[model samples]
Target: MRSRSWVRTVALGAVLLGAAAGQAQEGKMSQGVKAREQIEERYRWRLEDLYPTQEAWEADFKAVETDLQALGKCQGRLGKSAKGLGGCLDLQFSLTKRFYRLSTYAQQLNDQDGAAVQGQELNDRAGKLGTRLAAETAWVEPELLAVPARKMAALRKARALGPYGHFLDNILRRRAHVLGKDEERVVARAGDMANLPYTAYNVLSTLNLPFPEFTTRAGEKVRLNQAQYTRLRTSPDRDERRRVFQAFFAALRSFRESYAGLISGAVSRDHFYTQVRGYRGDLESALDATNVPTAIYTNMLEQVRAGRPLLWRYLRLRTQLLGLDKLTYSDLYPSIVPSVEMPIPFDQARGTILEALAALGPEVKAILEEAFASRWIDVYPNAGKRSGAYMSGSGYDVHPYILLNYVDSFDAMSTAAHELGHAVHSYLANKAQPFHYSGYPTFTAEVASTANENLLRLFLTARETDPKRRLFLLGEYLESWRTTVFRQALFAEFELKIHELAAAGKPLTADLLDATYLELLKEYYGVAEGVVEIDPLYAIEWAYIPHFYYNFYMFQYTTSFIASVAIAERIFSGDAAARDGYLAMLRAGGSLYPVELLKLGGVDMTTAAPYQVAFKSLEKTLAEVEQLAAKK
Candidate 1:
């Protein structure tokens, strides 16, 4: 559920609105109250970790852009010899690494406080530079494909290219999909145009749109931005939760048509790429780069559908525990055991996460320690800082940067652990693999993060003796299972159905999307059986999700969470092999396909084994919680 920037050096096209860290209930700080200088040095991330100063960054920025000419000179000569190809690749990787450093620095500055105009300009410049780099280096893949398969094999034996054989082999494997020089150029040129919908969606969501303020039952006026809406939805006050839910969806419903149009454009863009690449559909088109089979996606949806009874059981248990006649959409979030949130300050959350993560081994523990001690995190919420938690791994040589508006709650601790998982993964990957292979695909990206959260749960649940407190922690874990696995699977289903309709030449109108989503919601929540009631207005929930524009990305969250459950179980059982295997998978990075690397880590996601394992784990936790509740 954590927002992530991944390996893409460019700024995110869509700024997703919700927080993985628990959201704040009000705007505690007035607008423009805190300047970047006003923050304590210890709490601020050391951007100097990447570049010592703005002057240093500017020098390198100019140098990297000029280095593109050096790259341009080697273009036509790549096929002259194996050594020539290796030299070109060496230069290419070097430039990209430097570019990643530069781009990530600008991104970190901009994210520190999103209001700084200078930061925004630098971020925009970095993005344009990235687009230019993509165009400049577009010839590499096509030209490499033009070489005979036999030549590539022979080239692998050459000492210079031997290190890159894995990368070269991947290119040759996708030979059929690689377009010719002119067509590749055309596709590359159209990249910016194809991204318009995403750009527009980000602007509309983060800046231009007006979110209404709502008054709570306490007679307090609160503005319902994305963060406030998320926080209030889980308020102990049922009336407040109801008000927040209605107001939030009402605001979204007003812009339903706009969202539909933007999302339709995104779907069409996917469809265009699918046809251009000769893939069967949009799903295959998206998965092709990672070399994952379409069956994995379909099987995940089927398995999650099969697990619906358990999902329903959990919901019924929640309703019964709350003593409600029937569970409504608004009632889904309040804690099962208590009416108040357990406050956890940032310093305490930090110690708890580090201790929980100790099971991963000492090497990882050291990385987390450095991250905290070295100001690698930009902690606390500020006047104009970006909301939510995300790890920026674009700093290749330097350490990863984590941005979080941490509130003192257990969820915030989980968010910290989740992001630190990413940091540790990147640190290990960069250390073990070369720059070219350091970045992981989105398919396996969430494994380490969610696995960390699993470890935290295992640590916390075992140590706590109070029955109600243990039940609360366990219920939160179950909610993670629901949201990360079941709920995301539902989202994956919606994405698939909508894409299918779009591919079949059906119009993606607001009514059509609303009805399709509402049906899926009913099926998943089992409204007919009285497990939960869905308000008609809640059908517009699809409009609030920014992930839909991400092009078949939500399914990976389900898959990764399931895989991590299996991985965390083995590691938590004190299995040395499992520990090493998980670390090795993180270190392997993009050198291997995601599925292959995961298989090496002892979770073969292509089969039903891991999915079944995950369900069993979920069932075990449910039984433990049920057993504890029975004692009362």
Candidate 2:
């Protein structure tokens, strides 16, 4: 039931359109009026939010092209001295800023249809130019590695390149894995081709797949693709939800062999890169790139396993609330308490999110206001709009841009809050840290956003007056635990098994993959007493998830949920010190390792405490839901 990548593409385009087209309803305005209007007038988003005019963007783009070409002059000189290395880094940072501005403008322009033709051409050119610029300066890493460790250490102290010390240290740490100039050049040139398999799969899935049409419960015909699947999963009628799932899985089942090839190519790609880099294993290689320990990844899986009993307990509660003899995979998406539909308007949702986040202090609130007032948000869904939501942040020089599909529903509102949490995290980090440390790792990135969701859930639960509404809110919280934590853990486990099979030199055919996934599904769902049927075809479910292409990435969702729950609890418990500590973690960015950064937020991911706390919270919510059902 999770949102697909293509939806994100649509949602992103919609955000761009919303910014350019303003708030006119579909068919209400003329094409010329929509096209000619600046991003701010027709939509809630301010395209002018980043740049006042297309002419201004051209000027910035030209400036960046000139500066990027100048970076070639700094090659081979980085190892001369600490000052030289610092100068090169400073220039790189400047070039990066210009590139970010140009790229953001081009993307915004392309998002709007009026700007689509020229905008897309410009974007492609800028991308190619940026890659060329990056290739020119790729020699810096090799040159830095050539410098003796002792000499580099001395330079760090003598030259007082304080902000860049961590940056240099990271490069030195990877010196053993760093390739020679010729090898590095070969790898850099292979970048575009290296991603061919993933690119091919994306094109086929997004553009070529012939999604089937299905009849909804309302008797309306709908084409069942990724986006329609999202809509169908949330259908009020259970039969409609079931039909959609069956049809969708059937489509995937039919293409099992093709999907297997795509998945195999992705897994092989990971193994290839890891071996080339001399990593002991693929998981280690993936985690090492972000400086996150492998223990954290394994710990997440262990914790989720330990909490299986709690998941089973919740499943029983779900069966009871839905008045079903058995709970199947199809039953999972519908609300156990069907009466609780809390539709919050976009404006009211904004107010609610701000009120919930009040514990983060006034300064945090100001940034949220800026998001609204400065037109940083592109709100609403339109034809050809990208699906789903995301927060895109570059650095301090360029503010964050948020993309959303607001349908005046609580779920959409929740998405807005989630992405804004990312924006706020980026804003604080960029403001507090230097350019070198402005971005955080993906492992830590989800913590801020998930924590915001937790806080918002708590605030809404506390304020609800009606019993049904309270149950509905509680159901939403429980659903988050089920999906983000339990379901992702299921994914992580399946991925681990697949990789182990590959590591053992076993071939992963379609049949083998199906068997492996079905077995995991049975274990996770606890299908004793003939309660639920584990469909054999559902094994192809693995083929649909794009995150599997990202090595060892799914485990972060489970770990992040655990970390966020603990932090949100502390902040809501009136602990001002805890709130400050959490804020500090957001500001630390990539200045420290993910585990170390999390420690400052009072959650020691190295320990079992966070996982235990998150499971306990799940148990408590289930208990409350059960009690409410008993009264009913």
Candidate 3:
């Protein structure tokens, strides 16, 4: 109903989540997953910065409810005059800023401990409040659309309304799609139904679904939750990895119909917007929100599909390095260089990451230091903690927070740098821009986070003398490219196919979904060429990923990964202009469209230039991986 400045406040919370420890109380970090109470206070996030006490959070939440009535009073007044419009917007943003804080606090609290009833209740309360906010503010866009263009343009130029030009223009960009006030209200009310799929999905997947337990090679039994699945999939023991895949996917297979129903409903929700809004397709409708060209989406698909040869090359090399006759799906996650072990303690990893990111300049480095020291991160896996890591920057006034299940591995260190990139971006943008322009979209946001990851890898690569370690680093980078770039592209293709199928009036049955996914998996992994064998059971892997419910959100990972590779290469090469331009992009924030923001960061994602550079970088580093392996 409105820009994600407020609507998506909870988004930055748990996207790709990671951690380590120092204090006398932090020794538990080296152990297996513990309860949230077991984590040292120094390692936990200071959400109190947003609200020092529960009473304070309640005060703000109550204030928002009271202010929502006041905001509604100005509802019909938006089209009255410039002063009225600006004043109305002022109240709205203020309420949203406060709501964002409430939502973030509740979300992180629940995520840190899903079993806590109080945290779950707080999160549900925040959700209801968000729905109310959307329903009330839904009229703002339709009313603005009703305003005459001549007067609207003049209002945009008005000194009081100057800051709202971007926000207002974004609404006008979808002018044809904006419906009558009543129609807009209906769509706004449907927010709950639109949210049902993801909501039901999270409940079932996170809280309810019975994740199968497995015993490791050492006879240690473990419950394979999503986070554990990710961490264990990379096991060096082939038999163990196969069993992990079998047990985890078999659990989803039992609920295949339910997952299919949920995901199919997700696609149907997108289709509803497409048909109602007169969009070319769901892709058009989704991308149109951020002013991205559909060609950008299609172009990425074309480029990455054509670049499958590089993936095959890496796979062939991987097979040789692993001494396997041929690669299978399970073999993909283990280290190609088993001789190298990259583990750094949490405190030591902190220094290594800071050193890697120093090219970002002292100003950012200072903020990075503050982020670490100020407990801006929740840094260990505990009972009920959400899997994956993400950086939430929606707390415009309180600074950014990172959710990580740090396992004290090198990959976890890279994840810390990646999410910190997002934190720094939020810190810079929130500091530089106003409330309306502070929240950025995922497209450019991913670039910022990934850029930090690239810088870390490059910084490590340039310093390492051991060929095995260099190969390990190179292998990690290549794996990032595979997963973030090519693998996400394959996902994009599957997403589009499912959406198209749903639009064509076909049911997304579990059998159909499995067949479709397996087809793409086979093609993307070069299954037909005998490079890798894809098991049908792994097709349910889609059910494991949370992003499918995100509505065309996965493609940006590919696009951003490409952009960050180039951005990091330029900055690490000591290009002052490139470094400045890249940092400037983060500060620019949601003030610009996603693509234009990339241009500011010195990469044109619309063209093939960024793709070329990224592929070349991958190719170059991959060659070194081969040479290093050869040396062994």
Poorest 10 consecutive residues of model 3 by lDDT? 17-26
State every prediction's TM-score relative to the real structure: 0.86, 0.87, 0.83
- What is the alpha-carbon lDDT for the whole of candidate 3? 0.84
In model 3, the clashing pairs are: 16-388, 16-389, 17-388, 17-389, 18-404, 18-405, 18-406, 19-406
RMSD of each: 4.5, 4.8, 6.0
Worst 10 residues of 2 by lDDT: 20-29
Q: Per-residue lDDT of 249-329 in model 1, one digit per residue for the tens?
A: 998898889989999999999998888878889999988877888888999999999998888889988887777888899
List where candidate 1 sits over 4 angstroms from the true fold.
Answer: 1-49, 52-66, 109-132, 148-150, 181-193, 196-215, 219-232, 235-262, 339-347, 380-387, 404-407, 505-511, 628-632
- Per-residue CA lDDT of candidate 2, range 504-564, in tens? 8988898888988888888888876354666676667876776665567678778888999
Q: How far is candidate 1 from the true structure (C-alpha RMSD, Å)?
A: 4.5
Tens-place lDDT per residue, model 3, 164-228, is 88888788888888777788778878877887887788788877889887898889889998768
What is the overall TM-score of model 2 with all chains considered together? 0.87
Residue pairs with backbone overlap in model 1: none
The residue ranges of model 3 lying beyond 4 angstroms of the native Cα positions read: 1-69, 99-136, 185-264, 339-343, 372-392, 401-408, 502-515, 535-546
Considering every candidate listed, which one attains the maximal TM-score?
A: 2
Alpha-carbon local distance difference test for all models: 0.83, 0.76, 0.84
- Candidate 3, residue 388: lDDT: 64
